[model samples]
Target: MTLDSETFRALVTEASLSPSVHNTQPTRWRLGPDGRVQVLEDESRRLPVGDPEGRDLNVSHGSAVEGFCLAAGRRGLVVDVGHDGVHVAELTVRLGGVSDPLAAFLTQRRTYRGKFEGGAVAHAAMARFEQSEDLIVAQDPDHVAELARLYDEAGLRWFRNVPYRAELVSWMRLSRRHPSWSLDGLNAEAMEMSGIEATGAGLVLRPGVFETLDRIGLAGALVAEAAVVRSASAVALFHRPANEAPFDTGRRFHRVWLSFTQAGLSAAPMAVLADDTKARESLQADFGIGGERRLITAFRLGVAPARDLAAKPRLGLDALIV
Candidate 1:
């Protein structure tokens, strides 16, 4: 059965809402004959310096594809997804009779990076989160500690280099003033910084604090130690057996993220941890992802509490659409 054009359009729009590295919505959409939806990577939207290897882009596109699949599935549709690289994925939807209540989450889900409520996540919910073969969720305090070390190591290594630092600054949208970097780059507000503070401080690390912060920012479990702290209730690290042509990482990310969204969780990625080879290897060593199957994305999951965090805006659909 064929889906109406309006229904297909809404699904694509919902899919595009998926988060990316610094909110870089890198996926492109093309609707084909007989209800085929093509989700391609727009290389132009890639973070060349920050994510030179394109790992973040893959995960971002994966999130989009995942959202698309969920949206389609909710409407009694079966989706077959294919990917060529971190940037491109193709999803073909054929109308099916299956019903998915979680389909409603496609529009409701948001990348919430704030203080999560106290108490352990329900085991049943966590079990559902672990169901994805492409992803692994870390629940133990030991696991969080090990993962924090990897994240700190990666941040220190990457942020120290002048080039990567400059690349990061380039993406920092400094104000309610500048606009070119809209919807994509890091919004100062999301960094736990207020508008006035962010504008004055810019992206430069303060001279002395850089050393301490380089080790671990406020995001890790360390800074929030005393508070009723929670990282992603279930931290999912997406990986592939061996990097396939282009879509290996993207395909893996999409399938896993979609599964999480299907299970009623607010997911947010911590790219600072995922970009480093050493960090990935350390995580692999701890998690035992051997051989060529490398880590492609790291996502944290939990119920988001009401807090005032930065909400990065997106360009209108017209701007993203070809």
Candidate 2:
């Protein structure tokens, strides 16, 4: 049966909340006459510099598809997703679906970019993650410190790339004055940055200014996240089978993150560790990751301070539906 406009709007709205690379929200939804929902990638929103291969972009779309499925399940609707060339996926919706346990965490999940409170994750939480075949947790303080250093190094390496830096700044809504501040991209408040800090970031990230700082050996220390990474109760490594498609990997990615939410913990992805070639290789070797597995991403797990942070900026439903 065809989904009415109201039901379609609700499903797409929930799906749009899924995380995307640089908050690009690149997926577009189209409802067909036959009632199948088509997921399409908005090529204009792609991160050409940061994600040249579109790997992360595909993953983002995958997560959105999963989000749509979960939203459907919550309403007692089932979605059968299938590969549809020229589109990300074609979803056939039907009734009689069971609600997903993870759906409850969808609205609660946020990327806690601020410093986590001082404490360890609950013992039960740690145990649950340890039992997962796709997760590896590093809790030792010393090991965490080492990983933090590597993460900073990898991040700094990317920061030195002019185009990459520019692309990042383009997606950063550093001030409330930005026209799209509350509509899309990474707004300052959502990043846990104060106005002063956001202003400072805008200046420091300028290519010439950053280069000058780097020449003086100040850039590394200025942008380093060692302290934040060290503050995490544990670092989690998320992996998938080597030959698996990123779309499939992304489906699991959202589930893994929601699992963190279910356990009453907060997390922020340390994507640099998985994105940088050298860093990825180092982590695989150091952590005994089998050759058959690919490290998709990493997250810093901990407790965030209690506060009502601002909502994540997103494009409206009009822009999402084509």
Candidate 3:
């Protein structure tokens, strides 16, 4: 199959569905006159304040590239991918090999932030999962209890900050009347709680809901953590050297993240433990991480439970295409 404008566009459309840090779709793509796809950083989409450097941006790029690779495979194009910078990865796709069976799972994969079926993610599978150098999975219930506390503490610290809260509110897409907001921020429907039908509104912590969320957030994090620990499967934590640029590390982090998704195991990045310094330092001590290596992202993997809420919508190709 030859690379043409329409085919390339279709490939990119499929690729954009991949997950990223904060759901920030930071990767930018351009097609050279020579017919190759060129990807670069759209610094505007970057979370400079929260991410400081472009670490998260890079990881987002990696995730995007992984999506592209999967899309290419589905289209019967074999891809050669590699990094050009903290902000970029160059990809060349050509006709080749059998399509990956997991390629179909890309668009279907979602960051299921609800309950997981109680069970263990087989030891053999867990062992294979640990093979990624930058990843870790915690599936012990006691560990889940500890991790839940960590996630709660992190959320408490994050939501308490006026600027952070403001940023979160800004990204929220509250209603169908305003469609763009859906592109980013946490969707209310995605949160697991009672008395609320899964609605794709912005993270609606209505007045009294804060206390409930406080409990649910803590419990959900614990449940997620325990799911990983109990099923002997929780999530994969990715990291690279601390001195590396944000963009550089992020690219690598997402590559591993999406690979897990393509494997039929659903995952979502959890940077709470990584972003919380005191927590990260303690984790370093516990996980035996040393020598200036730092955590980049973590993902919880498990079977998604069915719910009434609809899947979060994505911006149409026409709007996202540039």
- Among these predicted structures, which one has the highest lDDT? 2
Can you tell me which runs of candidate 2 are displaced by over 4 Å? 120-123
lDDT of 3 by residue, 70-133 (tens): 7888877888775665427667767884577667766676777655564454333556767666
Candidate 3: Cα lDDT at 128: 71
Model 2, range 1-322, lDDT digits (tens) per residue?
A: 6777789999999998898888889999999888888899889999988999898999999999999999999999999999868788999999888999999888888998888886545445767898789999998889889999999999999999999999999999999999989988889988888999999999999979999999999999988989999988889999999999999888899999999999989999999999999999999999999899999999998888988777778899999999
Per TM-score, the best of the predicted structures is 2
Clash pairs, model 2 backbone? none
User: Runs in model 1 with CA error above 4 Å?
Assistant: 1-5, 32-40, 77-94, 97-102, 122-124, 130-132, 180-182, 200-203, 206-234, 244-248, 258-264, 307-312
> Clash totals for all models, in order?
5, 0, 18
TM-score of each: 0.75, 0.98, 0.78
TM-score of 1: 0.75
Arranged by TM-score with the best first, the candidates are 2, 3, 1
- Candidate 2 residue 174 C-alpha distance from true site, Å: 0.6
User: How far off is residue 201 in model 1, in Å?
Assistant: 5.2
lDDT of 1 by residue, 103-216 (tens): 565555566555555345534577875656667788776676566566665766776776666677767776767684456666665554567667555623544445455465
